[model samples]
Target: MPQSPTAHDPNDIQEFNLDAVAGILQDEKLDYRIDEHDGEKVIRTGFINAAISFILLDGSLTMEAMWRGAPSTDAAAQVLAATNEWNLTQFAPTIRFFELNEGTLAINALRHVVVSAGMSHNQVGSYVMSSIESAVQCFEWLEQQFPDLVTWKDEHHDH
Candidate 1:
């Protein structure tokens, strides 16, 4: 059996559904796909030029964006510094960066809501949409500082 997006009061705390979250994305007319990954439903989508994902892990929703290209080794420090600066000033879905290696960096926007009586539909949608915007903003900032990292293949989608 499958579930559908269930409506709830904004104040309701116990009932939350990813399907409903997916429905909100649909209502917004965004292209998205939801599939099971490692026993959790992973939502695959994008906002503007950034790829976005939503995952249910350890009872919280994790939203993140995949950076289009990895920066060179020389730019790792600058990337981390910028990420630290952004984390300090940003609110609601603070953007972060993962330094996978000297030559690889990834950007992420994250929000966590505990399971149980959970966030309302509006809250979920807000988190998802806001994270998308935040990730794009972070990407832009990175691009300004590290032009060499903008190796994204699609010019139309490369911001």
Candidate 2:
């Protein structure tokens, strides 16, 4: 007879770590590096020239994608309107706009996940992939909305 499926224990828990994140990235065939920033482990990955970071913490993960297509200050109002619309409608990544300089308005796609009760490998992987996919869609929509105004500013390349 086929073996009975095993049930996942609700009490099974462990500190969320970069090793798991690395595995997820590898399984997805995405190139990434686990690095330290202010003593916290971060998994860095790139989509084209855009940079995305996965921050590891106890029972939690935060993904932030630094969008390369930043709008100029002259179009700040338009950018803000687009962000407002996205926030009001979408469910995945949260968009935050910051005035990086007098001329450039930068935006980041941020998502936070908390699994205090622990999660399965596949569950976590779903969250990781979905986060990336949503951010990409958001950037694409914004670019389409302002094709001429959007300017690329890859943070990884400036230095």
Candidate 3:
């Protein structure tokens, strides 16, 4: 006599491991944490960029940038909207943000945006390579012309 597909003996020891499979799935979704520090709150650095701690002070809102090559302006705008909404819904009230393309003009705009946002020069990248270095050099010149604001986190050595 052979056992039926839906039939199982109640006393049989089931030998499949379920927990190990779930653990592997969770690990794959985890983001890389680069740095963290505590002050009035906690600041963290992750795979893409740095994150400032959320504070209750007036004009104290958290923001971040995701800089990489994108297909088109429409795609970039879509990503920005999706990211902004996700951040607002999952965490803080609002976040100031933008997406920079891999082109020369977009790179220049990003430099200006970062300086205006009061982020450190080290945090920004030109993303120029090969023959594009000359164009990137021009953008750097433009960035030098614009003065950067001294942000609070750097002043207190919290970064």
Q: Pick the candidate with the highest lDDT.
A: 2
lDDT of 1 by residue, 41-158 (tens): 8888974446788887766778767766576656668877877887787774566667677666676666666655577777777777776777777777767776776765555654
Candidate 3 Cα deviation (angstroms), residue 128: 31
For candidate 3, write residues 2-21 as lDDT tens digits.
97688544333333222222
lDDT tens per residue, model 2, 20-54: 77888999999999889999988999785358999
- For residue 118, give model 1's deviation from the true position in Å: 2.3
Q: Output the worst ten-in-a-row residue range by lDDT, candidate 2.
A: 8-17
Better of 2 and 3 by TM-score: 2
lDDT of each: 0.72, 0.81, 0.28
* lDDT for position 34 in model 2: 81
TM-score computed on alpha carbons, candidate 1: 0.77
Clash pairs for candidate 1: 5-20, 13-117, 13-118, 14-117
- In TM-score terms, candidate 3 sits at 0.22
TM-score of each: 0.77, 0.81, 0.22
55, model 1: CA deviation in Å? 1.4
lDDT of 3: 0.28
